[model samples]
Target: MNILITGASRGLGLALADESLKRGHSVIAAVRSPEHGGKLAELRERYGANVETAMFDVTDETAIARFAAGYAARGKRLEAIINNAAILTERGSSIEELDMTEVARTFDVNVLGPMRVVKHLLPLMDGTGGVIVNISSEAGSLHGAYGGDYAYGTSKTALNMFTEQLKHAVKPRGIAVYAVHPGWMKTDMGGSEAPGDPRTSASGILDLIERRTAPSRRFSFVDYSGSAMDI
Candidate 1:
């Protein structure tokens, strides 16, 4: 499978790129900073042609469109797109203490970012029949509501809605869309005390993709372990 992953510079995105390469799948590692390639550059060096890097900021629609046009020109087909680029802001702030600017930024990257990617790149998957994985979180679930972190939580909630709507629109094209909670991983976003590993989460997510596991002919919300998550 040819997979395109946003935010591939670090954390779960990087882990997912690595795991996909290990599984012998081609990867387009999309990172905001091409100069700060870090481990992704290493992966390209080690895997040679199996891995490639794409530069784009998910918040920038023009950049996304440019990348998409170039990709189409190259005649490359993507089997999956992992919308993993996101941001977490004002994690512990109370409602009164929240910064609205930060909240808007959060929604831009976490919600609209994936929406933009899918809009521009859906053409690449036209005939390939693929999967779209929006990296959501349990915080998004109204069934498991919590206090504080309103920015991150609500952005994910909106993302889940987008995923569902996109699923319905694209099911006719043989494409499946899902919102996945990748678990609390020990990454820069998840922090040091978190117990889950990005590597494990990436592997399980890829497994779910390869299997095309869905609850029915609808949008499914699931955890990294392939278990259903309450909406």
Candidate 2:
């Protein structure tokens, strides 16, 4: 599979990149900064031609368009895109006290970022039967509980809606879209006190994708265990 993972430098995205490489897939490791993307250079050395790195900013539509053109020129098409780039505002004083700047920053990455990614990449993925997995959260579940993390939850909710819209628009062309809850992962963003390790979450999510044959109308909301969630 020719996989493109945004925010591949760390956390669950990095873990997913590692696991996919181990499975002998051609991977395009996408990161905001080449200098900051970790372990990817080493993996490129180990995996030889199987792994390649791409410097991309998710918030920039121009960069994504250029990336799509460049990759197509290389005679490759993206089989999957893991939309994992995001930010959180968990430690703010309170929902009312949260800084508005922080809210804008969160939406830039968590909401609009994925939409921009799809805008450029979806056309290339048209005939290739691609998949788009948005890294979503349980906190976005309005049926579950409203959380203290207002900004993060709101952005994820928007992401979920976008995923739904994309699935509807693309399913006829054999494209699949899903919203994944990586499950309170113990990454820098998930915090040290988080429950699951990054590796576990990545493995489970990969398994779920491999096992699913059809896209769901409800947008395929699932945890790391393949358990469905109300959207």
Candidate 3:
């Protein structure tokens, strides 16, 4: 399968790319900075033709449209897209102290970014069934909500709504959309103290993606382990 992973420069995104390549799947790793794509570069060197890099910021609509157009022009179809690009600014700020500017930026990336990618790339995926994975967080769950980082959590909530609506809209076309919580991995975002490893989390996520045959109300929000999560 041909898979595209955004934010493939590091952390879970990079790990997902590596895991996909290890499974002999072709990967189109999208990074904001191709020149500084550290682990992404290593994947290219290690996997050769199995790994390709595309430079584009997920928040940039024009860049995403251009990417979709270019891929279509090349007669390529992405079998899966993992919307893994996100920012965690204002991590500990309360609602009262939260910076609205940061909140807007967070929404732009975490919420609108995935929407843009799906909207533009859906054409390229036409006639070819595929999966769309929006990397969401447990923090987004209203039922489980219990903390700070107002902007991040709120953005993820919006993303969850997008995923839910998108699933219903695209199901007839054989496209399955899922909102996944990839666990608290030891990445830059999850911090060094995080117990989960990116490789393990990514591996489980890939397994779920490969085994998932249909969309149901039961799986609107789920973990990498295929367990249902609170939405």
Candidate 4:
């Protein structure tokens, strides 16, 4: 399958790309920077043209649109898009004392970015029977024990609603939209305290994407193990 991943330069997204390549899938790794996307470049070299890349920052809408048009011109149709780019602003601060600027930045990266990505990519996915997996957080669950997430949780909750709306709009267009909680994996985002690793998380997510059978309106809460949660 031909796949596009937005945050393939590091952590969970990179792990997903590595495993997919090992399974012999065509991958298009989109990074915010071409020169700075070192891991993706390394994969491109190791995979020998099986992996390709486009410079893309999910927050930048126009650039992604232009890139999409170019890929379409080249006859590149993606089977899936992993909207994995995100940021966590309340890494160390209490919600009340947190800097407002940091909160805005988190929304910019996590919430607005995915919205921009879907606005452009969903149209391309029309009639193509593609899959959209938003890398959302279980912290986004309103029914859960909400603690210190602050901007991250709020942004992800917004993303969850966005995923639900997206699913409704695209299901008829032969597209599948699902928000997946990838577990507290050890990554820059998940930090050293995380119990799960990106490799494990990536494997589970890939399996779910591959094995998903029927379509439904699922504003689902799913862990890396593909276990459904009480949303």
Candidate 5:
């Protein structure tokens, strides 16, 4: 299967690419900076033709548009798209200390970015039925909403909504959309104390996708382990 993954420069995204390649699947690794894509470069060197690097920022609509056009020109067909590009700003700010500007930027990347990617690239999935994974967070869940995560939390909530709506919109095409909360991993975002290994998370997620075992419901909010998350 041909898979496209945004934010493939590092962390969980990189792990996903690695795991996919190990499974002998072709990967289109999308990263914001090709200069900083050394790890991806290594993967390409090792995996050869199975790995292709694409440079584009999810926040740039024009860049995504251009990439989409070029991708279509190449007649590429994708079996999956993993919307993994995102930012975490105002991490622990309270309502009183919230920065509205940071909040807007968070929404732009975490929410609108995936929307733009889907809008432009959905055509590539045209006759090829597949899945779309939106990397969301448990912070987005209203089930146990807490304080101190105003920006990132809200952005993920909106992303979850987008995932739900997108599932319905693409149902006719036999495409499945899922909002996944990758467990806290020791990445730049999850910090040093995080316990979850990104490789484990990537393996489980790919397993879920490859096996087509996600819940057959209107919407699915799941953890990397394939357990249902409260929506």
Candidate 6:
């Protein structure tokens, strides 16, 4: 399968790319800065033709459109798209102390970014079928929301809505869209104190992707382990 992963420069995105490659799947590692792709560059070198790096900033619609056009021009079709690019700019901030500007930026990346990618890339998906995974968080769950990190939580909640809407629109087209919570991994954003590892979370997410069969048209926000989550 040919997969496109955004924010593949580090953290869970990079881990997902690594796990996919290990499973013999081709990966289009989409990074905002190809030059600063860090581990992604190493994967390209090690995996050779199995890994391809593409410059993609989820927040930039023009760039996403251009990338989709390039892929289409080459007659490429994607089996899956993992919308893993996001920002937690308002971590630990109370509502009274939240920065509106940062909150807006977070939404631009965490919410609109995935929406743009899905809208543009749907045309390039393989005719056989495809899956769209929006990386969400438990913090976004209204049933589980415990305050703080307003921007990140709100953006993820909005993303969940987008995922549901996209699922409905694309179900007849043989495309399955889902919002997946990848768990709190020990990455730059997740912090060193976080208990989960990226590789484990990535592997579990890949398993969920592999086993997904959303036949009922009843989309739900789920965890990497395939357990349902509150939206």
List the candidates ranked by lDDT, beginning with the highest. 1, 5, 3, 6, 2, 4
- Candidate that would win on lDDT: 1
TM-scores across all candidates?
0.97, 0.93, 0.95, 0.92, 0.97, 0.95
**Residues 1-231, candidate 6, lDDT per residue (tens digit)?**
889999988999999999999999999999888475878768888799999888978888999999999989998899999999988887888888989999999999999999899889988885847788999999889999876778998899898999888888887988877898889999999999999999998998787667543333365588887778876
Sliding window of 10 residues with minimal summed lDDT for model 1 = 211-220
Supply the global lDDT for candidate 1: 0.91
**Which lDDT value does model 2 have at 44?**
78
Stronger candidate by lDDT (1 vs 5): 1
Q: Write the number of the candidate with greater lDDT, choosing between 1 and 3.
A: 1
Candidate 3 vs. true structure, TM-score = 0.95
Residue-by-residue lDDT tens digits, candidate 1, 1-231: 999999998999999999999999999998887675677878988899999888899999999999999989998989999999999999999989999999999999999999999999999999988889999999999999999979999999999999989989998999988899999999999999999999999998898778745455344788987788988
Model 3 / residue 86 / CA error / Å: 0.4
lDDT of each: 0.91, 0.82, 0.87, 0.81, 0.89, 0.87
| Model 3, runs deviating above 4 Å | 212-219
CA RMSD, predictions in order: 1.2, 1.8, 1.5, 1.9, 1.1, 1.7
Deviating ranges (above 4 Å) for candidate 6: 212-217
The parts of candidate 1 lying over 4 Å away from their true place are 212-219
Task: Give per-residue lDDT, candidate 6, residue 152.
Answer: 92
To one decimal, what is the Cα RMSD in angstroms of model 6 from the true structure?
A: 1.7
